[model samples]
Target: MNLFERLSGVIKEELTSLVNQSIRQEDTPEEEIERTISQMRSKVMATRIAIVRSSASQARLLKKGLVILEEELAQAEAKREALLRRISQANQRLERATRPTQTPFYKLEEKALELEAIAQAADELNWTKKINS
Candidate 1:
């Protein structure tokens, strides 16, 4: 049998033995015996109710623990996302500073700026030559 079943049988035997020992006196009246049994039954019922309430209290505590763990997991995930975003930003900044020639966009921008500076210089030379003439 399961441990709970064995434990229940043991408890039943002990309670019955105690009740029998308490009421076994030959001088005890029949009505008094009946009253004693009723009171014992009430006490047993109260004990059962207390056990159920204790189990419910434990269940509530377990549920609260689960909620706390879920909240912690969400916070950890948010931290992981933030860390990844920071790493990506840092990598982009490093690439721009150290490897501009390796990136096509930076290379094109640099070429455009150089060409604009050359055009401006040529325009200035033409303006000066016109003034001289």
Candidate 2:
């Protein structure tokens, strides 16, 4: 991966090197100037293409990450709603005060809150990523 990025830099440097050598060795200044300008234009265009391609790849990866994040978020939301219903039932049971086996809503509520926190974090991360990409 690093090698691929470094190759772009290497290509740019090679183009500069060749242009400098041509400038020093050519008999006619006009010919050297024209050749160097052509080489520079090609290098600039190639760099732009490379940048666009990298941006496209990053966009694809970010989109895939968002898809996975969305599916996980949907599941988290479903779990939260189920827990809310259970908590409501527990409250109703508390009103009757028939059983003393466990704490009514604390544990389930705890897990629901934890999942909510994780979902929020994932959402923030995804937003930042998408904007940057």
Candidate 3:
């Protein structure tokens, strides 16, 4: 065989060997695609879990706030009732203070005493008998 022909053949054989080795070293496209899909699914699951946890926390906070508001409402109702009772007491006092005397005999007695005292204070006036008459 000629030296040039042998050399060419050897170089061609080396090129074929290198291509096969590269193919063997690299993963198939299908395997790479599956690995990426699996990683994305895991990330999605984690995100879903985080959202659920956040929602639960918010619900708990709202429940606490509602309880606090209800307690405040109860306190306000109690205060209103107390104020109403105090107002009723004050109204009763005002009514008692402003009401007129009901007995005619007591009214006459009071008037007679007032006139007697005034006539006594003024020596020249004789108004007690007039008031009694």
Model 3 earns a TM-score of: 0.36
- TM-scores of all candidate predictions against the true structure: 0.34, 0.31, 0.36
Taking the tens digit of each residue's C-alpha lDDT, what string does model 2 give over 30-65?
A: 455455455545544544444455666654554554
Model 2, 55: alpha-carbon shift in Å? 1.9
Please write out the lDDT profile of model 3 over residues 66-92, one tens digit for every residue: 455456555655665676688899999
Order of the predicted models by lDDT, top scorer first? 2, 1, 3
| C-alpha positional error of residue 110 in candidate 2 after TM-score superposition, expressed in Å | 40
lDDT (Cα atoms) of all candidates against the true structure: 0.63, 0.64, 0.59
Give every collision pair in model 2.
none
RMSD of 3: 36.3
Worst 10 residues of 3 by lDDT: 42-51
Worst 10 residues of 2 by lDDT: 42-51
Off by over 4 Å in 1: 1-55, 101-133
Which sections of candidate 2 miss by over 4 Å?
1-54, 97-133
Question: Relative to the unseen true structure, what is the C-alpha lDDT of residue 112 in candidate 3, on a scale of 0 to 100?
Answer: 96
Q: Could you tell me how far off, in angstroms, the CA of residue 84 lies in candidate 2 after the best superposition? A: 1.3
Which residue window of length 10 is worst by lDDT in model 1?
A: 42-51
